[model samples]
Target chain A: MSEKNHRVSRRQFLTYTLTGVGGFMAAGMLAPMVRMALDPALEAAGDSEFVSVGLSEDEVSEEPQRVDFSIELDDGWYSSEQSRSAWVLREGNEILALSPICTHLGCTVNWGTNEENPEEFFCPCHFGRFERDGTNIPGTPPTRPLDVYEVEVRDGMIYLGQINQRG
Target chain B: MRWNENDAKTYQSAKEYVDTAIIPLLPVAGGKEQEEAVRMGEFTSYLTDFLERQYTGRVYLLPPFTYLKEESTEDRLERLKTWTEHFKNQGFSHFLYVTSDSRWRQADARDLGELVWIPAFSLAEMDTNKRQQSIEQQAQQIIPLMTEKWS
Candidate 1:
């Protein structure tokens, strides 16, 4: 009876060890595949996606119109809207949405034909200036290009997303 | 040379001469210091005013100005974004005038809802000489554009 009990105990230990090893090997084999399967879902977890600004597709003009509006962004538990303004300059068919905030010092820039200098967005704050294409000129304080906003036109209104400073 | 008729008739004579002569001659001095200072001051005031209207509490109009002394341009920009995120989280509008220059300066102003960059150019009038006078003149030219003033 004692001999039989010892045999049972040995069999139980072998079974547990084999199962543990098998479980670890299975986990190792499955980890990469699981990550691959879940990667896109994890990346898309945040629903703070791009919003569409209501603008007619025909409204986009060759001339840059100052698009001033507000959008609501999720503020943790609550939601809040923030005002943002950008110049949507249409080049042929493509739209280049530029932030009016000067890349030089983040001052609001104005676009008017300077009798002294032709059409350009001029920063009156320190004489820093930018071309109509939102490119910063050398010798100016602003080193980076004006930030561009991801925009999409839905129905007849225009929607904008996060402002990104291009690398 | 004697002061010209332009000197007697214009407020910019002292500034112009300084810009042409004194400023150019100065060694290792950053050009346009005065102009930079005036612009910075105007920006600080504008941003502060915008923030005050947007937020009703914990607005640091003149925060520890020495906040960004050693911070890098990227760090400064990140700090600004962080501040905006914080304000957004608090259900406040995040509106602030960030610096135009790639480098964030030694001084910045922040309230709970806004962060205004007090530019490096604010030091333009520190020296009581020609450059300082030029900055004052430039301030006159730039001040009117900033219609809203923070009292």
Candidate 2:
């Protein structure tokens, strides 16, 4: 090829450099806005949202303890903080996090609340019972086992995540 | 269950389980400040919402029964009884009343419903966290009273 054809002119060089620099600067300003626009979609796609309930792995015992926690929720247009509670306990090497909502009728179940069912989770509404391991008693109103939350322990802090419904 | 079309559908299919109806009593006219009346309504709503969350399967949260506070106690009682009777006819076995009106305590409203009277306070003056904490504490106190009724 000819020398003039192979070489880049100053005008062409300045245009190429200016376009490259301007593209990067524009992207820098737009990156956050683009992310903000897609924030809800990104959040919906995230499946690993674990929330801490102020209960440590060391604190969890054989007996289930109710711990209250708050999680940020995004509902379409508005985002807000919501309060949630869970019954947590540690057994052998595995930590169990139980959802308090009863499967039969959705009334909250309290552990050791009933005199007759002292060792089990009792539902006062219809006298339903869940075993220590979150199994719904066979003859009880709950057709399925009590839902369990995904448990994660990080640096001794216990984090509870999405419920795994035992259907 | 809340008194909305979506909840009403759930309520129709599960009428046997959803037996309790939560009715709020509000005094719209007491010859008091307008802000005071608003506070009473606000507190009562918070209590009702808390109760519904804890007992959603069994409780139906109805709209408020607003009345003139200047009315005679007998007249209020009689009107409330009419409201209760309608709910009874509709198949509600339990009627829980959440109100900030002190007059309900003195009135012979036993047949009308189980009354939970919470005195009105200025929640607007408090910070967001403090107001939420205060409402929760107040609502928690009413839980045992309801459990007693359930038992």
Candidate 3:
């Protein structure tokens, strides 16, 4: 009676072993493929994200300076170099990298270019204004603050990454 | 904004902001100066593209006005007048006719549109890096002009 209770059918034993081995083998084959598929999405956000804007941490000042840089753009089948610019400002240890793109009309805003509104980001088109900290002043064309870039300081050089939106 | 499917929808929703129109005046000569004409076209179009990139929501880049080098600016201005009139009727408040053709400096083409004539040079002689740098520098200067117009 004890033997009968412990006994396993040969078919059941074979099926269990095969399923366990096959499942592990399938997972082993798919693990690298899944990682490879996710590799680019991670790369764009990881160490490969930061690009030097030809400025160093020491070069950053209180005033927002426009820094132009180029990045390799991939649109599936084709790749090209896309020129991009950002407004870099440093206040104490917290550095800020503002996207030049205006929130309202997508015009490039210059730092302190407007005669009436000096010491602010002024959009040439539609007279939009953003404060030094990227806050959109009320009664202005832009409804939201300017986007900011992720920053990294490597060897005292300023490197910038993807743009991030703020509330 | 542009004459593309995606931008067309954007323009429809934001018609008021897109008040300016840019037309690249391309020179296409068929003979000895053909290469120069192509270079001018390349350079002017690059500037127009840069301008569009800078002010995508406020500006609309129209298809280029490709003309033969043999045609006089006076004759071309007559055709461009029609273009300006048509776009103006469509509610464009400002028009910028940009080109690397120096002939525009001597051409009496006022009242048609604001002519932005940048002097063209041999870009082929430049390395890729220098060429891009020079073009971007020229484009940088043009951006202020467009902004000034808006102001």
Candidate 4:
């Protein structure tokens, strides 16, 4: 009876070892594909990278200056770098970065283009006008203020993030 | 305003504000070298695109006026005059005729607003940076001319 029990224990050990090794091998083969399937989803969620527009705190002035930067965008199967522009101004101790695109018809607006209103942002298209603080002129075509960007200052360098519509 | 449906829709409601129209004059020469003529057409379209982007809402970009290269200047001017007349009826006061064809320069078209003559550039062979620089420079030169019309 003792000899029969020893033989049964040996068979059980062999079976358990085979099952453990086989499971590890199968997982090893499936690991890469599982990671590949999840890669884009992870990237989509991890796209909050900030782009430095190459402006230091001192370079920022009260006058609105054009700053161009490029950002990496991943749209499912395709990925590309897109260039964008913004108008930045320093008001007192605050740094204000506004989108150059007009709120009315998506035209680019220039700072101080109108001689009569040197302090305002002027859009050549449709005569859209915005106040110095990016508020749309009451009687003008633009119904909303210009969009602002998320900003970060690190070691005297200014970085800009996603554009946020003004409330 | 552009020829696109979206811009056209915007134009319908804001007709009074859009007083300017740009008519790109492109010459099509039929021959064995059709490719070169096509390149010129593309270049002309590119320049017009830059102008449209630079002055988005104020100017309407009309479909290009393409004609035979060998067509008489007088005939072309007559067709252009009719087009200008139609645009005027639609409330467009400023008609800008943008062309690389120098023949239009000799035509007396003061009544058709400004005639902007841009020197032809070989855009087909240019790299992206060079092409952008050339377009930017041309746009810069044209801005003063457009602003003068506005004032």
Model 4: lDDT of residue A119 = 90
**Whole-model Cα lDDT of every candidate shown, in order:** 0.52, 0.84, 0.86, 0.84
lDDT of model 1 at residue A112?
Answer: 68
What fraction of the native interface does candidate 3 get right in terms of contacts?
0.67
lDDT of 4 by residue, B52-113 (tens): 87677688999998888788999998999999999899899888888887778898888778
Off by over 4 Å in 2: A1-43, B29-32, B125-136
Give the DockQ (C-alpha) for candidate 1.
0.03
Q: Per-residue lDDT tens digits of candidate 1, residues A1-167?
A: 57765665778899999999999999999999999999989866454366665455677787777766666667789986666678887776777788877765345776763445557776654556677778887897678778898777666667777788964
The alpha-carbon RMSD over the true interface for every model, in angstroms, is 11.0, 1.4, 1.4, 2.0
lDDT (10s digit) by residue, model 3, range B30-143: 879988888888888877887887788799999998888889877888898888899999999888889988887887666766788997777768865677788879988777
User: Order of all candidates by lDDT, from best down to worst?
Assistant: 3, 2, 4, 1
What is the per-residue lDDT of model 2 for residues A1-167, given as tens digits with 9 covering 90 to 100? Answer: 77888899999999999999999999999999999999998976566689878777888899999887877877898998777778898778899999989898788888998898889998877678999888899898787878998888898999888888986
Ranking by TM-score: 3, 2, 4, 1
Clashing pairs in 3: none
Q: Which stretches of candidate 3 lie over 4 Å from their true place?
A: A1-48, B72-74, B125-129, B140-145
Model 4 - which docking category? acceptable
Residue pairs with backbone atoms closer than 3 Å in model 4 (clashes):
none
Error of 4 at A37 (Å): 16
What are the per-residue Cα lDDT tens digits for candidate 1 across B29-111? Answer: 13556455445544444344343322112122223122323455456555655655653554433233433332443334344
